[model samples]
Target chain A: MAYYGTNGYGDDAMDTESSGPKVTVREVESGRCDFVLQNCPLALANSLRRVMLAEIPTIAIDLVEVESNSSVLPDEFLAHRLGLIPLNSMNVASGLQYTRECGNCDDHCEQCSVTLRLHVKCSSPENLLVFAKDLIMVDGRTDDIGKPVIRDSAGNGPLLAKLRNGQELKLSCIAKKGIAKEHAKWAPSAAIGFEYDPNNKLRHVDYWYEVDAKDEWPVNQKNAEWESEETAADFTFNPDAQPSAFFFDLEATGVLEPDEIVHQGVDVLQKKLAEIINGLTRSDEGMNGGMSPDGYEPAPAEDDYAYGRGGTTPYGATAYGQNGYGGY
Target chain B: MSNSAERDTEMANGEAEEDSADEQELLLGGLEKLVILPGQTSHAASFQIEQEDHTLGNSLRYFINKNPDVEFCGYTIPHPSETKMHIRIQTWEDTPTTAFDALRKGLEDMIEACDVVTEKFTDARDGFEASKQ
Candidate 1:
């Protein structure tokens, strides 16, 4: 059969049976989890990481209308801070429309948004620390989002700002559903650490060292454990070995669970493939009808940054050099 | 008498093909989903999936290789800068299966695998939530 380098993938862990891939959850908590995804390559593993980081949708404060502000923070500063607070978005996908698709109303309406009002006037003489919990879900429309995600269940959540006595900070903020690619606030996971070949069995890199490289270098316990019996007896590099097991150290914010992030990550890839299949199966003429040709248009910037929010948007930086052979 | 015209058309087609292959546009409705390489039998063939890297190619190969009918299935991204993924599939010669059939079946299998993961994760998620209370 001369398979893809019959001995290339020196991975005994590769499962050839029809049983499919395996996911063994290790230490799983409400906000974090450790797991190993087996019987897959780096491509699938990386796709999961990318999806969890930028594609998984979550609810965040997209827009904030400050009715009055006597607090220390400026309006946009306050708005940006409010936007960062993680909102409980368990029902976002089913409950609200992406502000862009909600053509029902140009302004805030039942179809598109959930209104969160923050009205606080410090009557106490001492300083006041305003937390995300203070942003009351006044409108019943917010039933979809539920409430803020407080990571420390026993303690008060993220601190928004501090105010002195007689100072007032009043705002009617709009929280909307979005993905991290558009605005970081919507990112479900704060971080995702993924590794396919932690021991570097693939020999992807050559370690540079001076004098007696092997004798000088110390072999870690984990790396030594991975060494086969023959290799442990005598060092022999497998030039064509392939990576099999993938370890994921996924840490999610209060907004989404570790399992949900992984599921949605795979879902992003599935939907992508389904779309490709649909495009291919369709006749050439009608192929354009269903497929969105205009690739990823980051959901319209919810914040106009009329607050003079100068974003460093690099324009026309990508230049493609001609690579066509003079004669074919 | 029409030799020049035929040559010009051939060159044009070649350039058009090169143009499409150069640009990887999986979701952009630009490139064709699959480009079957030339001069291979139905049982063994190389398919170039456009605008895709190892993410789809390697995962798809894993699924297709699981099929007992498949003798061999592997994929390679031609170059780092280029987004095209060339997947080579070989089925048992006697089996009535074609490489194209294996790819389609692999895609369905991948979807099934995704459903399984979602199901398992859902159970875990519910447990996590239940413990939160």
Candidate 2:
């Protein structure tokens, strides 16, 4: 309701030292939720979105050792598909260690990693659809931790591969801790839908239209509460208006619950800051003293700074420069 | 030759035979830095965080600037390849807090804010499930 071009949050949102967050959750279904964050700075909102998408570490299959395969899918292709399967890693961040950081063993030890094995052979006359449920943990050691998330009530999950009759496949893989930035398989969220200035009141996007502006773009349908009553398609432009509200519609992968991802993401963000704070307490050691580190030179600057669109054709150039259509 | 740094890369400097090593090195210490600006007290300093970009920088700026005692707070990623952010903080003259304390508070605020979102999202989720049944 606050997205109706209200300037009430102009001073308060910026001035308040610890202004409490105002959240309105519209809908919450399994693996998905629609919510609005109000009275929060756009930068802070973006941080949350970006952190949840890439920073929060999640468990996923990193290395796969194939034993045998007679199935139609190649070993590399099958391993890639296995990496995409969402594992149940709820509340396990505290226990897992990133394999790279856990230097106790060269590659992986019990403390740093977990193992899952799959060995199946088809004897039936028809082809068999192999699923993630078939991949069982060695010794069932992680039974308390959990298994691959079932895609449906029938216990069917992501299809890893298909095997014709008399075909056999065997594989043993290791799951390791990682962040989405390193590889997307570790990402916990299916999608983080970030929307700000839903009415385009900030004019962040320049609309391209051939005729009447209203005909090409309708008043935003999201603010139906006011748009329905007030059919006018325009409002006064406020050049100094800062974003004080935001809307995020997100969907969670089965690896973690919606709330857990937000919590872990915040933890990771704080940990990163705390590292810098810790660096403040440490002695400088005279800054690269006694030891020598290599040096770097500035990037080779071509005339790229003044390199405007000199090659633009006459017709295309008319839409930009001093006509209020600023070229980036 | 006087200001070689400002000149473009392709420009030819014939007179100056100065080796590249003699010129000042950019980022000599490989992103690990917490140097205080000359003539400034401990109350105002800069911190360099490694392996991070704007996701933390812009938001942390907003949080630290929220402090009434803070005089100024800002951050920048010196280079894209460096994967680090340099944050500068300056607190007010008479404030009890220091630059380091301001950064610590800003980071703590983000954690608490996350708790708020986690709680609200959980409640909304459970409430919706209850109403559905």
Candidate 3:
């Protein structure tokens, strides 16, 4: 069977039947992780990176209303700030549809959007800080909407504004599901990138030869300690130890885990490839069915055979027969 | 098209007839959401995007880094796991909106290129089948 490349797995680490592509976590935290991916092309790695950055869906504040604002910020400015607040999206993956596509409402409804209200009035003389904690889900709708109310997991909501004494502010906001491709708020990964991993290189020199300087090769020079034979160094640089392997750094937004971002990216990539394959297959089936270029109907089978054999004239000359007495 | 026009009219009329109802306990806001705010060379826009952590903030920063006109671009999530993403952008000689326009354009170009690739693949497959027949 033909493979995608001549050296199907590039430059060193050969793949056995059991070892195709290996992914081992190098480091992981609540928001970020790094992993080593072996035996995969750089192209696939980059595609996954792009998919993680642009394709994942998350919920965000889509609309806002400022009923009254005596604060220093303008209404639009305050609304703009309110819209930038991050909401927990644990429920997004469970089939929460985009508000535009929701069938139940014209613009938005409880099923498509969750409303948040922020109302604050400063009575003291000192400036007051308005934080995310102050914003509450309206109408006890969090339960009614079936979407969890976005909470300030950090306990203290991050500060939004500072209001002087006697300044009052009131606003209402709505959150909805969306992807980062439409807006940056929904991007799943905080940071994602990859670099090629150096592979081991083996060298067979005269038994007494000393290994070259560290600057000469990019791989770690510590592997030179493995030279066993005294006369012939038989040094192995370990440059090809992990061929076609890459070190990937991935950081997830609070909405998803780092591993889930990678998994979802691969899932999206597979789905896209499947769609292309399906489309190509459909085109092939249509053509094989003898569909005309502009239509789906197949060419008449008998007519095709008769035309190929020259058994019928192009304009029906056989109807006139040998004599010229045929009716017009 | 007609449906869109009707919706537009309804939206316009809805905005015209509205004043915030005080007794409703701050629950009455319209459907029109704030997407991007206008500015001179530097602009700040907030979207209702739930960027739980640095994912979107970093991705957008990466994207902004690719634009020559962008002077600086950054995002902050004021509340964790809350649905708000604030993006601030500064551009070199161009309006802040241009930076966002470029980002949108880049996305559109990628989509168009992908569509073209799919179309070409379909055409090639059909041609191969037709020749075999």
Candidate 4:
């Protein structure tokens, strides 16, 4: 949750010595974010990406009830399409749980789910483009409830299905919170990845000024130099830069904001790690005399007096090793 | 065994054992080999695994890609419909053992998280059912 200064590189920059993560948001809008992570390892960055992409839960159409369908697409095919449509998942942070996980006994309840009904009967001779806007949220929310869930970045209502004259489709879809591990529809982000950050520094301003307008610079000729001294020289090819830092870019599926996705990703990762630690700790404790339910149990050692060759001699006799089968 | 540990943890976490769940045999078998990659300061490994689908492959890639020591990590399914997944991992600035340790740790963490979710839901369900009485 901490924000680092915009200075990407400096001798006395944010303390890399400290374990605290240095997060600098380069750009953040509704569903897109570019951020720089200093003092973060590749693993942590990758974990954040993984969590944001798949682990972070989002609402999606899980179940569809079709009342009627006479379109070219079968009822199952139409339901499948509806299920793939992403829904706004910001409600997850607002104390909403998955329908199955919720306290509600009803399969379809408002507290854990949202319902969208689509009924399109094309009467015109021309083909009708049934946009996402056509699927009205029937749970008493505004008409625009499903509008933000569209995968199109432009927020335009995506065409759900095409209907010919006299063709109709009637269905109710239930949106529930689930992870992308279960299905791609629940993935919060369309893409999440990071690259190593090269911490570059400008050593000599004069060197850059001399190289300006000359094709000597390694980078693109157009981006070689600033027009004036006031403008900063391009450090596109700095050989010296910190290798540990990473630049991360995440594009959301409009289910959650990009910054929120990162926060949620980190939160979910921490909880997951904590759970693992707890399980390991419990297992370690169970090693001490705890009855392992359905686990391995060593067989008790057999007494030798009853079955050994020494039994033929005497109860207290020690068997000699003279015979091949004899033993102590 | 790790399987015993997983089962115990799942039971403690109130995970309902679904009879039809896909076996993690492919992942476990691949991990058992611990194939070491050549020409890396830190131990690196590349291996292929055949499973029923790409779910485990994608999950493993996502899990392993998060290690700081993992210099390069990528996976290819080879074909769109093929179940065989090839994963290549290169690690530097840390021991190859660290990468393996992280993989084991990541899988355990995922299992544990599922347990927690199952427990939470079970508790909520029990309370709801009790209230109905």
Query: Which stretches in model 1 have alpha-carbon errors above 4 Å?
Result: A1-18, A142-146, A153-155, A208-235, A284-328, B1-109, B119-133
Candidate 1 colliding pairs: none
Model 2 - which docking category?
Answer: incorrect
What is the C-alpha DockQ of each candidate?
0.09, 0.14, 0.01, 0.04
User: Residue A24 in model 4: shift from native, Å?
Assistant: 1.6
Candidates, ranked, lDDT: 2, 1, 4, 3
Q: Per-residue lDDT of A92-178 in model 4, one digit per residue for the tens?
A: 744455443332433447766778888889999999878776777877743233333665565546577899999998888877666
Q: How close is candidate 3 to the true structure, as a TM-score?
A: 0.50
lDDT of 3: 0.48
Q: How many angstroms is the interface RMSD of candidate 2? A: 14.7
- The collision pairs in model 2 are none
On DockQ, the leading prediction is 2
lDDT of each: 0.62, 0.64, 0.48, 0.51
Residue-level lDDT of model 3, residues B14-130, one tens digit each, is 844222221010110111111333332323322222122343344444445445666676767777534344555565654545544544432343333234333433443345446
Q: Chain A TM-scores, one per candidate? A: 0.77, 0.79, 0.65, 0.66
lDDT of 4 at A193: 55
Predicted candidate 3 versus true structure: per-residue lDDT over A1-328, tens digit per residue? 4111112223432233234445556456567876655444344445557777877666777677778899988887776666566666654644465554343566666766778888999999999999877887875643323233243566655577889999998888888766665567667777776555222223222223247533344542221222211211223344333325556678776667566666556555444433223322333344322123323222233211221122221222121111110000
TM-score of 4: 0.52
Two-way TM-score contest, 2 vs 3, winner: 2
Clashing pairs in 4: A43-B66, A43-B67, A43-B68, A199-A242, B37-B44, B43-B96
Question: For residues A127-148, what per-residue lDDT tens digits would candidate 1 score against the true structure?
Answer: 9989987888877863647477
